[model samples]
Structures are given as C-alpha cells and as structure tokens.
Target: MSWNRRSLDRPTRRIALAGALFCGLTSAGCIVIDDAEARDEAEEVREDLRDAADDIAESITDALEEIGEHMSDFAEELGGETLVDQPIHFREFYDFLPERAGNLRRTSREGATGGALGFHMSVAEAEYEGRSGAEVEVSIADIGAMPVIGSEGFVEWLDLSVDEESDRGWARTIEYEGYPAMEEFRRTRGDRGRAEFTWFVESRFVVVLDARDVTIDELHELRDAIDTDALADLRDREGR
Candidate 1:
C-alpha cells in the first residue's frame, strides 16, 4: 500500500516550519544559545518529526493492507470464478429471457461483452412491447467475465429491509423466488406509470425489469414471467 501524500505532507510542512522558526530565531539573535546546544536541539526535533511521520505512514499502510485482503476475500465469495474463471459470452444469457412476459412481447434482443477498471462483465438486453408498443426493457448482466462498462456500479441490495410509500407510488424489498429483490413503482395518469424490479441472483447475475405505462401488478407479472432459477443455474454450472 502507498501512503497518502496529503496526510504525510501536511506534517512535513509543519516540521519545515519548525526548522524555519529555529533559523529565524538564531539569525535575529532573539535568544542567546551555544551553537552546539542549538544544533543538538534542532537534530532532536527533526528526528522526532521523522519518527512521527514514519509511525503515521506505517499505521495507514497496515490498515490499507488489511482492507485490501478483506475485500479480496469478499469479492471471491461474492462472485467466485465469475470474477476470474472464464471468458463468458453474452450469448449464454440470450435464451434465459422470456419471449413473452405478461402482455408484452419481446421486440428485440441483444448481448455484448467488454472490460473496464480491471474488471470484465457480460450483458444480455431485450426490449419488450405491449399491444400499444410501450417502452419495456429487460437487462440481465453476468459480471463474471466481460468488460465492466458501467455495470460495475450496480450493486446487490443485501439484507436491506425497506418499505416506503409516497403520493407517487411505493417501493419495497422482498425475497422474490427466494432471491434478494427490490421493486419500485411510480404512479402516473390513471393506472399507467413507471416501474422497476431488480433481482440480485446468485451474487453474480443482476437482472433488471424496467417499464413505463405499467402498474405495480403489471411489474409483478413481468417479474413472475422470467425463470430466474434458469439464469442462476446457467451461471453456477458454467462458473464451476
């Protein structure tokens, strides 16, 4: 681990100021002192400052090392082989999506793979349309072995118990199909509105259900339509 410059440097500036003050006092003859004694006092102050700086630096480094190790263990536990095991193709997620969800029919489907910030991920996206051709999209991401893109920012909501309501709509977390999940709905004119359902599956795949002009029940219908078990099954098998 590297030391933070701002932290160490500030103390260093103070040490320099101390040295400068000593020189200014000597030059101005503000205090009479033997040259040898003055030299000994300055050396002691400088040595003390150096020791303090080293101590601070060592403490920070130790803390950072410990944190890095813990994060490494957590990351492996979170995704396991998905983090480093494979060259996963987005195509694996294609068949996982349903052709028909509720009243919506899939209009298009696509997949992509890429890397970013030293991490890789794969994504499968599908667009759905109702009889009225509204905006409905489903995205499934396998963060095992593709470019992170922006998917790295998506995090699992673990052990979060939330149930909130507003005049617009409501949001809550629930164990859907035994998986940690969250669903949010916002009301619009009549029964139409916007909604999203997020499923953090198997600690690897993140599935999102996004739609407009839909009610909360409609969102559940879409969520209920997908076989999330199939999605997790694919990752668990392939990851091993």
Candidate 2:
C-alpha cells in the first residue's frame, strides 16, 4: 500500500485519457465542419434552384409575348375587310386568353413525347360573292402559322352551284414542302347554301366561311370546291 505516486499511475488510465481526448477533439472538429458544410451546400442548392426558376419564368414570358404578337397580326389580317372580300361583321373571341398570351386564348395539350399549343380564329363574310370571282387573299403566313412568313389570312370567294350530294368544291393545285402536312375538312349544307372550311394548324383550328344568309346546299357546294392545291401552294410559297 506504500506505493510511489508515479508507479500508481496505470497504463489503462493513460490510455483511457488519450482515447477520450482524441474522440472529443475529433467529434468537435467533425461537428463544426459538418454543420458549416451542410449550411453552405443547402444555400448553394437554394441559389441554383432560384436561378433556374428565374430563367424559366423569363423564357415563359418571352414565349407568351411572341405568341401574342403573332395572334395580333393574325387578327388584324382577318379583321381587315379587304381579306374578307365582303362587307361583313366579325365576332372575335380574342379577349378570352391565357394568362401568358396577353389576350389570346392559348391552350396546351400534353402528349407522350411533347405537347401542343394552339389558338382559335373564326371569320364570316359580310356580303355574298356577287356573280363574279370574289377572292379572299389571306397571307399564307397568317393561316400557315409559319415562323417568319405572311401575316394575313387568305381569301376565297366563289359563286358556283352544284347538285345536292355532289362533290364539286373549288379546285386549285398548290404545293407544300411537307403537305398533306396539314388537312382541310370541308362541310356544306346544300339547303342552307352555306359552306364551312376548317384548317387545323397543329392544335389551332381556323374556320373560314362565307355564310351570310347561306343555305345548307350552298355550303356543301363551297365545301366541295375548296381549292386544296391552292392552299398547298400558298404554304410552299411561305417556305421561300
């Protein structure tokens, strides 16, 4: 029991002290670094996300502006009386628009790969084509929906008569780079003497007609006589 102070200090005691000190220091250092690094990383991620969001917002705004400008041009062309070739009243629904396109109603569709976006424009003739070759000369750009082409809708007016159930619409041969690229559906009501032609641009469908007191039978004749080739040619010209 009468041992020296130095000899009383056991190896186990020394090792224990060293281990505790090492663990304490290591843990303290780790805690400091982990917290700071975590905070920095979180901040960086937040900044990146914010930047991406801003870019996306800006892009969407730009696209909306562009779409709006195009729609305005289209409306102007369609609104113009010269294009209609008849003194007619127009009913426009442009005010009902998406938030992005300013004042044009734009709709987006989801597809497996991508999606489609579109707008609508409907026009009616004010006067009937008197016994003459009346034409609606819309710019290929307006209806074709080309990126950089004409900015007016085309015109078509005819005074041809055909039998009931007869397929005698206007005939014209036009060329397009990738046509049949689009399709045109025509409907005529012979009794009503009214004809309606529809052109679908991707998702946007434009219905063109000259139905001022038109009979169904007349519509059928006009439907049958829409110049498909002429439309194709108009589209081709836009490419040039």
Candidate 3:
C-alpha cells in the first residue's frame, strides 16, 4: 500500500495511517490500498476545514454588523436625532435677507451646494451695494443630517476674544431669540473694516452676515431682519 503523506496534516496523516493499518489487519489476504482512497480522505478533511472556516467568517461578520448598529443607536441617543435627506431651495434663505437695507441694494444673488460628513447643506450668497472697493456679503447655510449642536456646546466653542492692538476682530457670544449667536468686528487701515454676525438655528441651520467697510449697526440690522424662527421651521419640516 502506498500513502501520500504530504496530502494530509501531521495529526490527520497519523489517523489515516492508523485506519489503513486497522483495515489491512481486519481484512483477508494482503490488503491493498490505492492512492485514490487516501486522496478521497484528504479531500474530505479539507472540505470539513473549509466549511468550519466559512462558518467562523460568517459569525464574525454578523458580530461586526451588530456592533455597528449599536454604536449608531448610542450616537443618536447622545447627540439627538439626525436630519433626513431633503433638497434645499436657496431662494428661501435669500428671501430672509431684506431686499434693500438703507443704501445697500441686493446686487447679486447665487447659491452653492456644500456639506460635510454625511450631511447635506445649502449655501445662499447675496452681495449688497459696496462703497469704493468694499461690499457686504451675506451667506446663509442650511445644513441637515448632523447631530444637534446644543446651546451649551455652542457656548463652549464660542469662547473667543478680540485683539484690539493688532487690529484683529473680536468675537462675543450673544443670544438671539433664545439661540446662541456670535458677532465679530475688525478694522485695518482707513475705510477698510469688516464685521460679521453668525447664529445657529435649531442647532442645525446657520446664518452668516459679513460686511466690508460697514458698521456694526449695519451688521446688526442684517441679523435682525432675518426671521430665525421661520428659517428653523424650514429646516425642521424638511428633515421630517
């Protein structure tokens, strides 16, 4: 009898050899084992091992999927509900801006698409009349599909101070209709000044108004003109 020892592992080879020896001793006459029988036994062992490996792989994959689901649930519980998919209309945000404020006219209007992570965002830009080389640019971004940025979180992130000597802008946190907001102002050389006001609505949408060669009063007016409640509702309803 010829045995292909290399076809099997050490333990399997030993078992096969033992079985063959037992069969030969129990059988009548000179027992003759062919290579085909050895090969068949080796193939069966390989199939069993492959089946076990496949089962283990499937179990691991299921476990990973379960873990991912649990993590997503935990995140939602900690960070509030996530927003849903919805198309944004830039004109809706643009309408929030006054058609005309004093001498500043709505010179140009445009919209752009932007977002981060798995979130969706609508960016609306409106430029106002400029004096000399300065103009006021207002941009409103309606972001969806993100965790809520609560007022407390906003306060922690809004801690910033101004550097007057460096002519750099300063930021101070404020509350607008019960929502956290920030305003910043900076002035460089003659007639070169900038101001910005930003506020988040329902911890989702954000409105930003920036001005060049404009006063803080103008920026305040722009901020006041926006109906934040309506804007917040817009985002909320769309998410639903």
Candidate 4:
C-alpha cells in the first residue's frame, strides 16, 4: 500500500506508521489491505497526537499563571520574597543577638533547629539582665521557605488586629518600621513593667523581644541596637 508522509512532521509520520502497522496486524492474515482504511487510521492517530500536545501545553500555561498569582499574594502578606532558600543555621542566627545593649548584660544564650506539626525552624536566642530587675530577651527564628501546612504557625499574629487596654496593661497590634508588629505593655509595681515586641523580619526570620520592668523607650533602644539591615541581608539564607 502507498503511504504519504510528505505533509506530516517527523514524529507524526512515525506515529501514523505505527498505527497503520497495528491496523494491518489486526486484519489477521488478510490477503489485501484496504488503502482507505490505512489512511483513515493514520489521520485519526495524527489528530490524537495533536490534541494531546495541545492539552499538555494548555495545562502548563494555566498552572504557571495560577502559581504567579499565588506567589504575588503571599509576598504582599509577607512584605518580602514569596519563596526563599533553606533556613540559616541556628548558630548563625545567634550572631545576630546582641550580648549587651546599653548596660543590659546577656545572661543566657541558646540555639536549636527542629520541626513539629508540619513546620520546621531554627532558633537562636539570648537574655540580658539590667539593674532594678529589668531584663530583655531577644530571639531570632528561621522558618525557611515552605509555608507551614495544617496550622497557622507563629505568623497567626500577622493576621490579627487587636487593640485592647485596661488599667494595668495593654495589648495591641502596632506598626514598627513599616512592619505590622505585636506589642504588649503591662504594669506591675510601677507605671510600665512587662513588655513584648514581636515581628517577622525578611520574610523568613521572626524577631521577638520580651522584657520585664523596662519602659517602652528602653525596649526600642535595645531593638535599635540589633543590626536589622544585616539581619535582612540574611534573607534566603542557605544551609543544611
């Protein structure tokens, strides 16, 4: 039987030939093969290949578009990159904690890395004690790029908007250096005693400062001592 392949691409011709051979084999020892039947089978095979290619290309394009939109929304919420590299080592995170800030002496330091409940993180932290029972605790946690599934994780505070106050304390969400932060202030023996300021930095690191018997200004001072620019440079920090 005569076969025409001049109008077809190389792959189409190869597949069409295979289809025709299968059709002939199915005839089961027939003496003569029908030319029209061979042509019809080849055409059908060519159409199926073209349809499959179109479907794959369409699926890929749709997937890419969806991913782009998803990442954009995620970045807007995070105020940084949608996806970063692996988390930095906890030892490296410790280097960001200050040993002393305006007379406060570091009393303790620790670092560790682990995962639980669908999340992984590396943490480094230190505590500083000053005169008059005042103290500051600083910590940095690297949570890597993968968003924690099955739980809100620590970032649940980012989605909050609380502004509550009483005679002795206040808890609210405030803005710090253009970042939405969580801060709480309470009075113990004096006007202002316990304080907490926490924020997510560089889209991957969580910076939290908890203090006791310190004024708000003192908290900000200790915060200013941390090299935030250097901390931000640690974005996408890669490690094991």
For each candidate, give its TM-score against the true structure: 0.58, 0.25, 0.55, 0.58
Per residue, candidate 2 scores C-alpha lDDT tens digits across 1-240 of 111112212321232233333434444333333488787876666666556555544443343344445545654655432222111111221221112221111122110010013321122122224222221211111223322123233222111222233353332222223221211223343322323333322222222333333443443344334344443333222111
* Model 1 accuracy (lDDT, Cα): 0.59
Q: Please list the residue runs of candidate 1 whose C-alpha ends up more than 4 Å from where it truly belongs after superposition.
A: 1-84, 145-157
Better of 1 and 2 by TM-score: 1
What is the per-residue lDDT of model 3 for residues 70-97, given as tens digits with 9 covering 90 to 100?
Answer: 3344345556445646436555676887
Best by lDDT: 4
lDDT assessment of candidate 4: 0.60
Task: Report the Cα lDDT for residue 91, model 4.
Answer: 81
Clashes of 2: 38
Worst 10 residues of 1 by lDDT: 1-10
lDDT tens digits, residue span 86-110, model 1? 4256677778777887787887775
Q: Every model's Cα RMSD, please?
A: 20.1, 31.3, 26.2, 25.2
Give the least accurate 10-residue stretch of model 4, judged by summed lDDT: 1-10
**Model 4 misplaced stretches (Cα beyond 4 Å):** 1-82, 116-118, 149-157
Report every candidate's CA lDDT: 0.59, 0.29, 0.55, 0.60
State, as a TM-score between 0 and 1, how close model 4 is to the true structure.
Answer: 0.58
Q: Kindly list the per-residue Cα lDDT of model 4 for residues 1-240, writing each as its tens digit.
A: 001011112322233233344444434333443698886776666666666555544443343233334434543454533244445767886667777788677876755454333234555667788877888867676655435311243245356787989998888877776666778889887765998877666556667787899877778878888777788777756767
